[model samples]
Target: MKFNRRTFIKRLFIAAASIETFFLIKGSISKTHLEKDKKELFNAGKADSFEKNKPYPFLTGQFFLRRFDDGGFIAMSIKCTHLGCIVQSNIKTGGFNCPCHASQFNRFGEVLSSPATRPLDYFPITIKNGDILVDTSKPTKRKSFSKSQLTYV
Candidate 1:
């Protein structure tokens, strides 16, 4: 094998460049998972509480608010886990169904079928400053879920 200084330096440079590029891609993927989508076109407290009988997706929060049997509400996530597409609430059916793949989730964000193994990602809610606030930053651990977890408008 013939060894030359120029060839040795070229091989070393190529190896270093490839390693740097791999690290850069890894960092970007990690950040995308952490960062929530900023296109929160809807703000909380934007819509007046309407009668449950009306068909309306609540403003600010994700899904439409419905009066449960216990008189509580559940705020379901609008983004579908399957493909990040927005899921629509089938008011007539009384649950949210993803139009993309027909993945159905109950108002409580439960997985109603096979395509989606996990339920809808929930947003934490707290009443602050006389308005219902939804913090979309950190996701919480999944526990025994009930439709009651959905926040009402």
Candidate 2:
């Protein structure tokens, strides 16, 4: 193969484009499957182990788990739906609030203020074998909850 600047650049561009396309497709597919396979691939950190009387650290996202007064579990995302900034969790308020613009989300990820067109995203969680697993990658329309994903004793 004879070396040429134009040919090298063309090949490089093609490679980069192909790689980007592959990743984009992969990401889309995963998002579609977010709800289906969340429980399977979450062995490393299960979401079902979280207890009812405890609020647990979530997978790197805008949510945490806490037992509701009625003895059920609520997983709330801390991400601001307005700008994607991490929502601040207030132990005093017992809810997640966005400091970036003062957006407030209830225990169930509902928006309590304006400037947020959509509600805070919630993940389907479950507890299995004493760990907590949350599907932080995508938010599903119908949510599931389990404390088996948190890797806490």
- Model 2 lDDT per residue over 49-146, tens place: 44554456555544666665454554556567789888766666555688788887665556777576666666655555655555565554323233
Residue 125 lDDT in model 2? 55
Model 2 TM-score on a 0 to 1 scale: 0.54
Model 1 spans with C-alpha error above 4 angstroms: 1-43, 46-67, 141-144, 147-153
The best candidate in terms of lDDT: 1
- What is the alpha-carbon lDDT for the whole of candidate 2? 0.61
lDDT of each: 0.62, 0.61
Q: What TM-score does candidate 1 get on C-alpha atoms? A: 0.55
